[model samples]
Target chain A: MKIILKNICKSYNGRKVIDNLSYEFTPDKPVVIEGGSGIGKTTLLRIIMGLEKPDSGEVVFEGVSHEAVRFAPVFQNTRLIDKLDAPANVRLAAREISGDAVRAALIALIPKEELGKKVRDLSGGTQRRVEIVRAVLAPSDVIIMDEPLTGLDEGNARRAVAYIKENMEGRILITSSHSDLFEAFCETLLLK
Target chain B: MQTLSLSAALCRVTTSITWADSLKNGTARKILIIVFWLLLWQGASALVHNSILLAGPYESLLALCSLAVTSKFWLSILFTFLKITLGFVLGLITGILCACLSYRFKLFREFITPPISVIKSIPVASFVIIVIIWAGASSLATVISALVVFPMIYHNMLSGLEATGSSLIEMGRLFRFRFIDKARYIYFPQVLSHLHSAVLISSGMAFKSGIAAEVIGRPLQSIGNGLYLSKISLATADLFAWTFCAVILAYLFEKAVSLILKRLSAA
Candidate 1:
């Protein structure tokens, strides 16, 4: 399956964020949207994920109905249920994943003690990791991550990237980051 | 020898002072405060020298004990308690459903505004009279209590739903979460916090209004009827005792509801 953005344009308050952009995202290759701040990387990701509409143009999903396409996203904010623990947060989106699997995934990036603690009580880096795990485990045709490693240190960022790559499972992965962290594994789409 | 004895005496004094300090700061302090108020009430009653006009705490307790042994007293309590609780539960369910509808649809919200406003503006006495006429005296307390509770729960729950984080909701949508998952994870915690305060406030209001309705409607075998009878017969102690019973019941019910809500949030 493939997603094609044809002449997509979006603007806010008369300022164009994404203008006349076109791209094809295929499952065969992972894509990393790299750009400086305010370059519309997040906006483009949202458009592709169907969270936001383009001002003029369309996103054509080939080999699947639009309704049949499922997305798992790591938002700019951690966007976790604050009252729920790390494993519970993942299970909210990935209910089919077993409890043991959730705990195993979480223990890679966070301490075992932190597993039962509410996501709100975890540190920023730990919360980001929880978000990553949630997206990775969720059953989706496409995974869209907006700065998934924003709060992580270099070691954890590398670990998160490696985890995400291992679990791609033949699904298309579209991520936006200001750094060149995913350049080694993902085809860079530098948004102008 | 003089110095040793002086040091021992100083230590004893310090220990005694510490004990006194702890008493003033603990549950002992609360007991003392209640005793103080009871004494003041007793003194005032003594000065009045009229048991009919002002029943002392002792007389009120005596009245309660006497009523407690009677089957009619228990029956009246059960009648009022069941009716008011039913009304509250009905109001709670209706309010939650309405709030959910209002939150999801702008048209429903607009449609509900005038009725909620009317309910909010009208007096409880007026509703009791209207309910008595429409549904008869037997159902008056239940209807009135529901009328009183509905608007409070509706308004508060609506506010809670409105205050929910939209970003999280959007994330839920992106993840293709089912309605139950969205409600359980995204809406429930937010609404539960607001619902807690609403329950505490509305539970007391429900009991007060429910009893007032029974008193006006003269419902058979109700606590409100018991209060009315005591008043008409100049049984001031009995009246005070009934009032005490109502307050205690309201307090217990509120605590129970709070506990259930706390458990729901935990789960």
Candidate 2:
């Protein structure tokens, strides 16, 4: 899909956080948005995810723009409700995914031992993976992940990176702290 | 001078403390306390030397026993119990309705404040008299009880509603939860403990005010009416018995409500 994020200016209080910036993210391959903290990398991700509306400018996905495109976001923090268990937390968006499908998806990403435990009980790495699986399993046109590799040790991060590479269909846009990951797997779009 | 021995001190004491002696078996301790109080009453009645002034514990117990055998006693208890319970239920409904309506409309809350303040500050006896004059003796007690209870219920329910978390509500909105689903998941869970406390408090108030109404209104076949007659006839034993019965009924209602709350919390 062709995606364009044009003149995306955002500000908090009186200061400019995202200045008049323009970029395009499309799929012949995966794209990474790499930038420093307080450099509007997260703000840019939020604008693309439609979680925030810009002070000025537009985000267009497949030429339809923010008002048109169907979107899903895997947030930086694993925002699982404390009350629901691991499988139930993931199933909130994709209820149609059967027990076996949930089981299989969870088993593929999360260790089998942590499958039955609640998201709150699971370690940070496992919760991160569950959130990624939840995003992957959800039915969405564009999957946007903000800081998706956070908290995972290198081995699990690699496993998750591989899973996303294999399973993504339409488009993958990720915001990250490092560009080396972008170099190895996808084209890098540096935001300074 | 040498200090008195334990037995001499015990013998010289004017009063006994039974509650401290109450070990794990609370019921037995209560019985012991009752017996102690009964002996005290017996001793006091003997010292006074006037049956008109004070009836001993046995006299009250005998009165209660005799009253138990009579149909009027049962009828009085049942009628008073039903009227008070009904008043409680009505007050609960009114409180919840007022709370919800007040929350829904700011103007209504402002309008209600003056009257609630007036009711809360004024004496129950004043309300009882006013209601008796307006509604007559028979219906007055129930009305008084309900009025006495409304503020307690309404304020608690309002606080409960206010305590509902904004974040959880936002989550519910994002999830597109229906009104029923929102209430079940978000509204009820937050407000339940509050409502539970309100119910317990209001239930006790209902009994007290209901009986007080009966006393003032003189409703036939009610515990309050029995109390009134006993006072008129100088039957101190009967008065004590009926008052004991009222206390027991109130205790039982509180216990029953507490049990229900426990079950609800468990669920």
Candidate 3:
């Protein structure tokens, strides 16, 4: 499947965040958007995910209707339910995945004891990892992550990257981060 | 100070402190507080020296016992309980549905504002009189109770829905969550938190307004009628007894609702 953005323009409070941007996303190559903070890396990802409407542009998808394309996203805020445990939060989107499967997937990045604790109680790095597991386990044609490695230590960040690569299953992956941690695995898209 | 070994003195002080802490936090402390209030009430009743003016706790308990043995008293309790509960459940359901619709559609929310404002502004007594004229005395309590509950639940649920984090909703959208999944994960907890307080407050208000409606309408076999009869006959003890029963019923219902909501939240 191919996703293309043509001359997308978005402004907030009379200031342009994304201006005259165009890119084509292919399933074969994962793309990592890199830019300075508040450089509209998130706005670009949100626009592609249909979370925000572009001021002037159209997104064209080939081999998939926009309505039919499902997405799994790791929001910048790790939007896991604060009151739910790790596996339970993962099951929110991945309902078809069994509880055992969720637990097994989470156990790879999360400690066994910590898996039962609510996401709010876990450390920031653990919560980010939980978001990654949730995104990977959810049934989707595309994965959009906004700074997926925000709170991770270097060691856990590597593990998360490795985990995402192993489980992405040839789906189009688009992520935004200020750092180049994903440089080796993903094609870089610099947002000026 | 008496000379003593450090260990012995420390042990004694620790024991005293533990005892004080238990007294402050344990069920025994609650019982003691209640007993203190009961004694104060009894003292005030004695000072009045007239049962008609002020019924003591003993007189109220005695009146309650005498009423309990009679079939009419039980029937009145059942009648009022069923009517108020039905009204409350009706209000609860409609309030939740309306709140959901209002949250989904801004036009509906605006359209509903006037009626909700009227309900909140108008006195319960006025509503009771109007409802009696419209629907007659037979269903007055039910109608009044429902009106009392609806706006409260509606406003609280609406606020809860509004307070839900937008980011979580966006996440749900990206995940392509089904409607049921969105309700379960994204909305349920937020609404439930607000619902807990709303139900508690509204249920109590429903009982109070419902009984007041019955008193005003003089329904044939309701707690309100019983209360009215007790007042006119100058049987202060019976009035106190009926009021006691109403308070207990309201408390029990609130407890049951709170328990159910708590369980739902846990799930």
Top candidate by TM-score: 1
List all candidate RMSDs to the true structure: 3.2, 7.8, 4.4
What does candidate 2's lDDT look like per residue over B1-267, in tens digits?
135576667765623444444434666677878889878989999998776799888889999999999999999998888777777778878988999889779999999989989989999888888887887877765777788778998898888888987655543543344576566656666677788877888888889888987888798899999999999999999999999999999889889978987887655
Query: Where does model 1 sit among the CAPRI classes?
Result: medium
Better of 1 and 3 by DockQ: 1
Q: What is each predicted model's overall lDDT from 0 to 1?
A: 0.92, 0.77, 0.91
Residues A14-46 of candidate 3 have per-residue lDDT tens digits of 999998999999888999998888889988988
Sort every candidate by TM-score, greatest first. 1, 3, 2
For candidate 2, the iRMS in Å is 3.8
Per-model TM against the reference: 0.91, 0.71, 0.89
Model 2: CAPRI class: incorrect
Tell me the TM-score that candidate 3 gets on chain A alone: 0.97
lDDT, ranked from best to worst: 1, 3, 2
lDDT of 1 by residue, B91-153 (tens): 999999999999999999999999999999998888888888788999888898898899999
Question: By lDDT, who's the top model here?
Answer: 1
- Report the TM-score measured on chain A for model 1: 0.98
The parts of candidate 1 lying over 4 Å away from their true place are A107-116, B1-19
Q: What is the TM-score of chain B in candidate 2?
A: 0.85
